[model samples]
Target: MNQLNVSEFIATSDFRRFHFLLLIIGFFCVIFDGYDTAVFGAILPSMMKEWHLTAVEAGALGSYSLFGMLFGAFTFGVLADRYGRKRMVAVTVILFSLFTALGGIAPGPKVFGFFRFMAGLGLGGILPNAIALLTDYSPKKTRTTITAIVFCGYCLGGMLSPFIGILAIGNYGWRIVLWVGALPLIFLPLAYRYMPESSFILLREGRREELLAVLARINPARKIDAEVRLYEEHDVSTRVPLAGLFGEGRALSTVMFTAAIFFHLILGYGLINWLPKLMLEAGFSMNSSLMFLIVLQCGAIVGTVVMGYAGDHYSLKRILVGMYLLGSVTMVLFALNRNATLAYVLIAVAGVPVVGAMNLVQVYISQFYPAFVRSTAMGFSSSVGRVGGMLGPLLAGWLVDMSFSIHSMFFAFAIPGVLSAISISAVQHRYSTDRSRKGQAEVGMRLAGEVEK
Candidate 1:
């Protein structure tokens, strides 16, 4: 008779069509997530003009959604851990999609801000939940690469926003670009149907039949006879999900991750929300400024693929540290750049570390905690990071208002990249749950891999 450990089975399973479906779905969902989040930056210039706003007010306005994300990430993480990932994903998609469209129709800044804040709640919740979903299903060996591929949808969305904005804003106005956000609501049903439930949920509920069915689908070549018995590899912890994030020797690392996310977002949002304004201030036309965003995002997409593959093959931590270092250098170079061709290249490199590196950080935190608390860990870290993200645009606005030269401004932004690298380096990797599980999963893989839904 053969005995089965469900977690080990899924972790060790071979790649299948079902796994590919999840990857494709995860990729597209995050693409929409990227689009909705980046839309605000796209419209920021127009909002400044129509609202008769100063740089400070516009930055403050951008922070409203960040506030919503802070609350949403924590709240959604707890709920996803308790209820399930798929349900929470649906709730957030609808929440952001509807309110984002509403923002387009808002009569004034107050109304627009309110709508954005509401949408921010959804935006805040989306990535953590989506990543958690993929983390649960992807094979442990290729998890970093798989998750990174799905995560790139975010940069792809960032790229999409400016391209669309340049075209539509000329005739249809910024509002038309936002109205496109509502498109995701149409795919909600298909996602709801196809998205797999967390195997943890099924195993916890003791749904042996359904769990077995999913395992069969995960590895169609595998067979289970009547002689086999199945067991969950890791039982659900009775302890509160948030509490677990700080337990099991994770407190220092959790704080370190939170801080790293904080600095990353500051650099990311500062560049994302303010780069166009910076370019425009340097005498570039609005379209040219927007084109810079597209180039930056393209660099992010390339960086994400390269770094993900490198992290998988080399040391994940080392790659992250190097990326942060590289990103900071790019910013300094951008400050000294005189040639247009070189400036474009510099902006692209900045995106690699500023935006692309965050995806790897997500991979790290997701793998750090136990399955029971993964979402909570990601959410709490992201929510706290949202505080920094909230401040990024506002800080940039203040920086722009000051009497400093553009050289000084780029130098200031580079500081956070260095801080982010330091934070990651300080994390205590000895306590990571993923490290412990890797050898165990590898052993189980040699036993012909476990399969799950």
Candidate 2:
């Protein structure tokens, strides 16, 4: 009898408590990641006032964290693939949480930037591994949806940050908000206790007993007879996973998606990092600016769920293309609006297509690669996007320094979405062609097998 593949088992198994527990735990991990990342934007106004910094300096500060994230995504992603995913998750959570708190206590802008950069490293490290763990466990039928649910933590954290800033900044100051980010450290023990090692990794390392033990816990009702063999479908003996992304006819898809992710992140980080300050400049009060941020996140929550559902049922590539096109329109409208209520509405709408689509990029990328290279692919792609993430806020600041009008700045941001839409369209064509070829090859194999029989 052929050995049972772990992925096959995952696809065939009924949804169980173990599956739901994994999603909940993954949600908690991403929540703090979102919170710490967004809090900087929320508290930037206060930082500017306290330090008397210019827009360029503030933008550069935002880039500092993203630069760390770029490094972390590539470095930690490789490490997780080599060593394991479970311990990396726990360590990153602790590292980011501690440094985020230290950021609150830093006496100067440079020191604060250093702490933020360190926290970025942790924040960057969590995502690809978290998604990899979730992918290893989820059924293929629901992989995209499960990822979206896990990512909702990001929107939730982003939503909560502005509110926290509003309440904490008013009462205790911006530092208090940073100090609150340290709360994730309290959950570190839970991460260690609950998170399981990847069965795929276990099997690859010849740890059969350990792999069987995890699989059994995953479905306690099922008994594993001695006759049962366990395995995966592909050979991953090529020690370097990153090379596989360039092989297996994946190079073009990888490059196209990387470019798409890069541009999408530019729009995402740019808007989130600078929105409050831009609103303040537009004459909104501190409380109101934070409220705009809240509204934006609320829209993001809605958009994320909607996109997740759509991706599951419809063509993900087409849906993403439509979203980017819509985002272009929304950004322009957001720039032109002046009425307070209407501006709120426009910003909220902007969040749906812009922030919403940005969330979907990871889900789309995850689906593009095979299991062995999934984490590495996610890490490298996200690392590329982090380059955009770093450039975005810095560009916003530089544009501000150059005294560019807000309208022109937003228009510049919108241009990337158009390019992203075109690139994804090309990707869709390539993917369709690949699938057709796969179908033909499978048909040929089936015929040959029948003849032999």
Candidate 3:
């Protein structure tokens, strides 16, 4: 009886072993997402030469994937809320894995583009679910830190893709690179066997037994408190209405949040997708261009970890605004300075703040919404960003095709960075006002109930 009690206590604790395991799983999934997204950019130059494609054509192929991601993100957001996070994650992973492998076997650019777009759909669905799942398991105090650390997987994958592309393309071909990219499929079985559904979701669904089961698996050494029971009561309204995010006082804030994601992603994805080509056009060799891209991503990884800490300790909004300003200034400097060494240094500096800002935005979005609508909010915001991401590469490709100087293209990208700074600043201001209003309203309600009693 004592041993059973110990086992139950261990399983029900808030800081359970299963929670960390889930984070690891999420980290791996996101790493694959980063690798798949970055690999195309790394191999684009070679693919163009082999297929006799123009810059515009390649950009279209890139946009095709983003378009697919938009659909996937939106669809999975709704499905995850209506169905379950685990189910949606499983479906999306399988979808992306199969399509990513198929991309290697494409007979032409058209076929390849279709496969990439399909893969994008899976990519889109996986991330929001991962965020929701991780958030569910994470302790409140360490939530932001854990989320940011997990996201570093994205940066690591992006940084490693160029090296992988360089070696694989040289030894075999771009097709082989795509084939190897599908290796993430190996994780699906693990997810199926080991990944627990969100405890919150279980409580929401009124499956108390299942919730207890998961809690036991996660935290095998704690007493279940009355607070845990309270969670079930509050989670009774788990079926979130899709329009609820825009209803009540949430409409304007939701729109602004969506716009903020749009502009940030435009700057982030535009810079990432075009960095290698931009460096090459600036007279760097292919190998050097790839190296510079790697440096940029390495900076991003460091920035993400640092900013994650800052977000928890300081003002997230202030950090986000400052990072944008830093990115804009660095963009202008990179455009002006043609020296390869100096350019690499500037890009690295710029990348630190840019990726840091992006990571914080994801963390902020996850925290802003209640658990009931968290996945929906993440999905919608990410989908809107995907729209911007879809357009960014295409727009840059158009400029490149029009014979615009690489310096001019960098300046164009910098405009969005500046705009993002302004947009996010406005969002921060509005958020403060909204918070104040909510606080006052709550106080008023409490006073009214006291009077009635």
Candidate 4:
């Protein structure tokens, strides 16, 4: 492939526009991901009644999608590391958008489940790659905040789903909602045309010219010093085996982070998957239940923005743990409430902390690993968490079928939230110490090099 020309890349307006443009693209991609993921839940009752499906079968549809996400997160994550972040992101979006659109034409639950699985694959792949892409280009000081902003797109998309369901599904059908899920395809072409490959990838590949071009695009105002070429390390390999995450010094942190993710996703997905049904059981009308879900997601959007800012200024660990703990408490309150206003308030409060912590978890994971292994770490953690996500709905379905009160289900999910908060708190303490050591090591290396010179 021909290398990008640094001078030409810097001179164009496209270079100056690239960062914000990529952020916009990332935002839209995540929005679609949220829409497609939540569609099944939003219209599950309609689908069940129309298809004469059992609760177990309807629950399988959700699990199948998450199963696909498990595979997609690992497979595409490795692909992003070996190939490139931009390419994989483009491929994932196209795959998801196409499959999501295909879901509109399913003849039965099985077929719908299959298409949703495929869409989940695309959904799974997009998130890690998108996080990696944003982190690669973002300024170090603002990395976590930028990631939180991108994650807010998911909440924003979720908040819009109930409105879409009430307006479109009521008028047309659930099929219209499925078809609208494909609207994300509009962003695929834009991603292909404008999204640049990550500078870190180019640096690892020893493509100095390409790295310079990407840097120029990211910051056109800064003049590149002639002697300050991209650091070329020939020993760097992008191919990181999944097993490497647990090898030697990396094992404990890896396992802890994975466990934290598992609990976080379990609570997050469980609540999201069952919130509407829970509301209905709590005596809300169908419209009221759906409206409450929308309010919950709106709280999530606001919480993500606030927590993102907080995560940057304070410790990510403190913010994440606090949120999860608050979520657990609010969930209990939500389950006990019967008053309409109180129920809505509790549910919205529960949603606020849950999603904000989820956003921080993504940001923290991305920061924990180095660039070459970053996507792989993201994939592994996400894949493990997806297992919990898959189980959440299935377990809830089983509990509901057993005639357990909705309050019991909420209490069960709350246990995972408490555990996850503890895990994150521990990991945070470790990461703080490790970061300090690494900083000292870097200073020592610099000092030794200067003395030798």
lDDT of each: 0.84, 0.80, 0.74, 0.75
TM-score list, all predictions: 0.95, 0.93, 0.89, 0.90
Q: Report the C-alpha lDDT of model 4 over 117-204, residue by residue, as the tens digit.
A: 9988988998899988887666655667778889989888787777788888777888887788777677577567878786556655
- Candidate 2, residues 1-453: lDDT per residue as tens digits? 534657667756766777888898899988889898898899999999999999999999998889989988877877777777887888789878999999999999999999989999998889888888887787767777888888888888988889989888987889998888888788778767877777667766777777777787677887876666776544434388888678756788778777887888788888889888887877889989888878988888888888898888888889889988988898887677667788888888888777778778778776776666777888898888789889889998998889887778888888778877877777743443214345645665321100000
Model 2 C-alpha lDDT versus the unseen true structure? 0.80
Model 1 per-residue lDDT tens digits across residues 242-348: 88888768899999999989998998887888887788888888888888888988998889988887777777777888889898898889888778788888988
Which one is best on TM-score?
1
The candidate scoring highest on lDDT is 1
**Model 4 spans > 4 angstroms off:** 1-17, 232-235, 241-244, 428-453
Query: Rank by TM-score, descending?
Result: 1, 2, 4, 3
lDDT of 3 by residue, 259-281 (tens): 87787777777777777888788
lDDT of 3 at 42: 83
Sequence-dependent TM-score of model 4: 0.90
The list of candidate 2 runs beyond 4 A from truth reads 428-453
Ordered from best to worst lDDT, the candidate numbers read: 1, 2, 4, 3
